[model samples]
Target chain A: MNGIHDMGGMHGFGPIVREADEPVFHHEWEGKALALARIALAGGLFNLDEFRHVMERMPPVQYLSISYYERWLEGAIALLAEKGVISADEFTARLTALAEAGS
Target chain B: MTADAHGDADVALRVRALESLLLEKGLVESPAIDEIIDLFENRLGPQNGARVVARAWSDPEFKARLLANATDAIVEMGYEAVQGEDMVVVENTPRVHNLVVCTLCSCFPWATLGLPPVWYKSAPYRSRAASDPRGVLLEFGTAVADEAEVRVWDSNAELRYMVLPERPAGTDAMGEDELLALVTRDSMIGVTRALAP
Candidate 1:
């Protein structure tokens, strides 16, 4: 797929910013997102190609806007839903429920 | 929470929700998640790659093997794992510098280098690294010699690359452990040279 994620050789994105003393993960959720995606792939929920394809399917604007791990999370969710491991409605309900409980 | 904080919180909530659903459905266990996290955090990372680079610097035969067949050579060093199964170690010489990137996506050598940094996966780095590697290297404070050729290797799903950085001068007396200290992750990625010892 010729998605924005295939960003090689494109122009105008600007100079690379190197963060000093950068940690392995910027947020706790980022690590969990990575672990979940790895587990999802490892458990045969989806293959590596399928996992990357789902992320490539993301809308260009949203794909560019989200952080690296956020894309991982989005891909994991989409793959899980596609694999019948979880439904969209269930995920939404759980998200809403968790948000509500936190508040 | 500020807007950014709220966004972070929302994403955090979404991940938690996903975990809960997976847990409820018996698709995944909590301890398994922790184990994965622990593996990446504690056991896997650039330290592994640094070890490889250090050994290659100290051993002529190992360097020859690593340059000839990186996957088997690295595995011999005990760092074989997923995403790093097919490896190619490009050596940096007096007249040639090698840079690695995944233009399609971030296909890094995870077993050795661990997860990539955010900039490596960002649009700017991905786009420019292939097209203007010398300029990219300049930004990383690595100025290659005027006559040296810059070679960029685009890593893919099936194959990954790591740079065999030239061993620094005045390191003839240094041991492998001391050599490891000079091998930064960026050096293995070919953005910068090994730190001077």
Candidate 2:
């Protein structure tokens, strides 16, 4: 089953902002992925009653996504915007193009 | 075979020591062009693990022995668990079913079962496995009785588990060699049951 952490279009977020590409690695648990997986597990295991309750506590997709992906073109731009990598106006314009393409 | 950086002491020692040792020689002078092989004595890789499942699937008497004392029964076949104890091999009878999880960290029978899949180590799997096993199995495309009490095993220092999936229907006459081919890794993990068709 898809774990709560399996995102619809969120893999390969980035290693761009990383200043150091050090050989020695420190393992960090992917929190956003874990959370998404937990929500999906709730979908699989819990009854509707419990599922709704758990969903209330889970984060919205917008917050969990990192930046750009092969999917979620808009969220990627928003991440760049939040970092001041792009202006809000630029973010909207790119997102508008993305929305029109899907149509 | 790549473990995350925060792996336990065993992984750290084995991986780091071997890599550095290889580099100390001229074999990998750059250390960047890595081509190191990891080996172990009596490695009970998947082939051995599959044999255990195949034997259990075909022999009722062996299954009984496996259930009564899994570690001892397994040792007779030459696969010995190093870190697990109180091993319980749960038979997947048609009337009842079984699955496994580590509510704590991934406490697995590394000797007999080999490495755990990525999903097995995640928090969602660990948390929901015991309480909502049926739905989890269903999501993974395994059959279950809504009426069947979905037994979820929580592995510990005391109790480690291996799911003996119900030998799937329509393969009674199939020989051991043929049957082993049908036993997917997921079948052993309890996400699905073994089948020949």
Candidate 3:
């Protein structure tokens, strides 16, 4: 359930719950997570400087849960797509995965 | 109900209330507070238990008894509930180290090991420690030997454990009290071990 820690970002994984035939986020907490993540990305609230603090002050669980990490991911993706940091196809795939995880 | 800011009355009042409530529900023949009161009256805090552990550190035969069956040995030493609860002690060895966690809330070996520490209750530690004992211990600053394989004990109704750490090296001549100083409460519950003093 907390397997997100092992990540270069795992694909097809964003659901909070794991059932035999269904991989889905817990309906209640996920929607909130996505909204928060989107806001952080669009607002430029997370940056490289803030990230070092994440590593220093937060344990693994808190590090990932912080609003800034998801926001940073979203911003990085947007910038990368605009500036050719990665191809558009790769960006779309990554964004879709992030959106799923943010669920 | 809101409790008094001072914790002193909190335990006492709660104990009284629980006894009365249990009695009303017919869970027991009597609402006797003395049963729990007796538990508190005995069972020295971690400091005293550590002293006993230190004695065992120096004494091979005693350590053997502790590893063999901790409950019997502890009762033989005159520590028990007025109505005692059974306790089982598990030893932490060189090849196979043990770490204990009350995954189902805070079921501890209170007879020998007294209480759980703060980190023990955190959802983060409990959820991760069982699956990742090595990582958690490293975070706790316990370095295990490369050859040592860690075993995490998830405590429940049927099985509970207390760790009997291997006596630290280089303290062969120390007296009982000095050895006990090395026996940390956390080590008994197996999150950490007593360090050599």
Candidate 4:
């Protein structure tokens, strides 16, 4: 799928923002997302090609709007649900629980 | 926080939930995840690529091998794994400068170079890197002379690329460690040349 996720050579995204002393991950969840992606691949849930494929399947608007790690998180969720490790209802229920808990 | 920021946080929350679910189902382990994160953050990174570049600078024979067989050469230096399995090192000469971008997705040589910087995965870098390599280089504050050429390599296939930046002119007296100090992650990605010593 030639989706918006393939942003290479497109244009108009603006100048790359350079921050002083940027850490590897801006937020703790970003780190966890990266780790989960790696571990999931390692555990034979999916190959790297599948990982990239899922990210490519993201809706164009959402792909453009989300941050990089957020995209990774989205990919992980899609992979997990597809693999049947977690159901769509379970994912929604968990998100609702997390929302109500205000975490 | 902005709505985008809040949405990002919510995504993170979902990730945490998924992680817990996986752990509970015995599909994955916490220690394994911790180890993977530690490998990326500490053990692997552009510093490893810097070392490879520095070694190539100091040894002509090693440079030949690196340019010829980047994956094996990189593994000789103890950096080899999934994403980096197919690696290619392009050299920067006075006449030609090299730039790398993955048009399909952010397919980087992560085993050696670690996680890519945010900008490398940004829409601007991806879009501009191939369409206007020179302009992108200018944004990176790297001036490619009018007489020179800019070659953009799209890591769109299984193969990934890293730039073996031209050694700075005044660095004849510098040791490998000193030279390594000047090889920024951007240089390897070909957004810029190696910094002058």
The model with the greatest DockQ is: 1
**Residues B64-84, model 3: lDDT tens digits:** 887787777776666562224
Model 1 per-residue lDDT tens digits across residues B1-197:
01132389889888899989888878789899999888888888999999999999999999999999998998999987675369999999989999999887788998899888878887889999989999999999999999999999998888989999999999999999999999999999999999998
Q: What overall lDDT goes with each candidate model?
A: 0.88, 0.53, 0.52, 0.82
Best by TM-score: 1
Instruction: List A-chain TM-scores for all predictions.
Output: 0.95, 0.24, 0.30, 0.88
Instruction: Give the DockQ ranking, best first.
Output: 1, 4, 2, 3
lDDT of 2 by residue, B86-197 (tens): 6778887877788888754456766676655546654456666665677568667776976776777777645678887777788889777877887766677777887655
Candidate order by decreasing lDDT? 1, 4, 2, 3
Candidate 1 fraction of reference contacts recovered:
0.77
CAPRI quality of model 4: medium
Which regions of candidate 4 fall more than 4 Å away from where they truly are?
Answer: A99-103, B1-8
Candidate 1 displacement at residue A16 in angstroms? 0.4
lDDT-superior candidate, 2 or 4: 4
Tens digits of per-residue lDDT, candidate 4, A1-103, equal 5677766657688887766556788888888888888788877888888888887887777777788887777787887788887887897887788778884
Give the alpha carbon lDDT tens digit for every residue of B29-72 in model 4: 88888887788778878999999999999999999999999988
Which residue runs does candidate 3 get wrong by more than 4 Å? A1-103, B1-42, B81-84
Off by over 4 Å in 2: A1-103, B1-42
Task: Spell out the clash pairs found in candidate 2.
Answer: A3-A37, A4-A36, A4-A37, A4-A38, A5-A33, A5-A36, A5-A37, A67-A76, A68-A76
